[model samples]
Target: MASRTPAPRQQTHLAVLIDADNAPAAIVEGLFEEIAKYGIASVKRIYGDWTKPQLGKWKQVLLDHSIQPMQQFAYTSGKNATDSALIIDAMDLLYTRRFDGFCLVSSDSDFTRLAARLREEGLTVYGFGEEKTPKPFVSACDKFIYTEILRASPEAEPAPSSEKSTAANVEEAPKPAAKPKPQKVPLDFIAKVLDDIADEDDDWVHLGALGQNISKLRPAFDPRLYGFKKLSDLIKGHPKRFELQARGATNGGSKDFYVRNAGIAR
Candidate 1:
């Protein structure tokens, strides 16, 4: 089988810090699944007031995921103690120089400066938040993932009983998972980037390199936002506007793929 791209020899060690004050318990399963694509989560920590009833939903989830909970009491009515605690911990983790990156999970914009600081120190930061997340927070990270695309695992299907009618069994079959709501593809951005970076002599550009450039230009740019699984798929889905080429593959190993504007005429 021809691989899409060569895999990195090593995964980035990441510090996964979550602000439980804003993020929900539902996305925990999907959140980690997304994280695996980048690297190992060496440190999984969530900051919140565990005593609050609102946080009760996260208790079992933390245990299941082996995420250590840091308790921070709310000392004032209007202040957010959890954010302060998480920020301090993130700084401490950054100073350790043990992690290759950080995954900050929250929809709140307060962590914007923290994300900017991490990038300033030369560590990659991945921010996870809802679509409502402020642009400042989204752009501060290396790549931002909208939690709207993340989903909880579906409950297991019940086994069919000998006593149940066939029709009933058919009716009870699990419904297909709901897809994330589609967002408009940044077609203008994609076209401009292709022209700016990899229209080399008006030739094809390596897909991997193109992906990196796209992330650099727009940290929150994800194919999932437009309902595609990969950058290549996103390009291919717009065949009228973009073109692709697969080159340099031997014996079912990884292949070097290239992409260019269809107008480039290969």
Candidate 2:
């Protein structure tokens, strides 16, 4: 019998399209970082009417991130021209066959069909939006991220009070105790997901694959939602429930991380 040749590995190339009208400027920094986990962002474009003062905040963000801004004027009243422009451009990019996937950043339900259509072509679609994003749009993508998880910490000091409010004259209200943030993704949920997706022979699974499975199971699952920056860190946090192993590449290059339920026999 002839030995089978190994297939060449190719890095995933993704096209990132942001609906500037629907997405927040604050999440742009963390959004790019999250997208980097899945693949390289080959084409980064944001659609909006730059002439509007509301979009002024995105101007500096786009320039700082090297994201191309595509202007789409609101040609008609009570209609979103930006969504139409983004959809058209998405199809154009799809036909080029250069990208392996696409990242659609918007909370609007208008892109639900666009995401489904791309998936039909065997392209991975990653959705980024707020918690209020419609269920149809969230379910259409291979994986979805809530923008709230990407927001910067709110621990910054409050802005200075107005000049008219003197320290002596101003009456301060009683400060309320800070409430603890609820855990969005439970550790047991993650462990259960790993058990179901693990290899039958060895009960071990690639950390990347496990993370993808978790996303598919829970569209809102995010490490940041639970105070961890990355999935690896989250897994490391529960050392008693999860075991992590770093395997060196056969070529002595990089290491691949794997995870399994701690209860499983080694």
- Candidate 2 per-residue lDDT, tens place, 1-266, comes to 99999999989999999999999887887899999998999999999999999988799788789899999999989999999999999999999999999999999999999999999999999999987899999999988888877776545446556986788887775343232364655978888888788768988899999987887877667787787878988889989999989998877688889999897765
lDDT of 1 at 190: 89
Candidate 2: list runs displaced more than 4 Å: 1-11, 153-182, 199-201, 245-258, 262-266
The clash count of every prediction, one per candidate, is: 0, 0
The numbered model that scores best in lDDT is 1
lDDT tens readout by residue for model 1, 168-216: 4456654545647778998889888888886446567889988999999
Q: Of the candidates shown, which would achieve the greatest TM-score relative to the real structure?
A: 1
Could you tell me every candidate's TM-score relative to the true structure? 0.86, 0.75
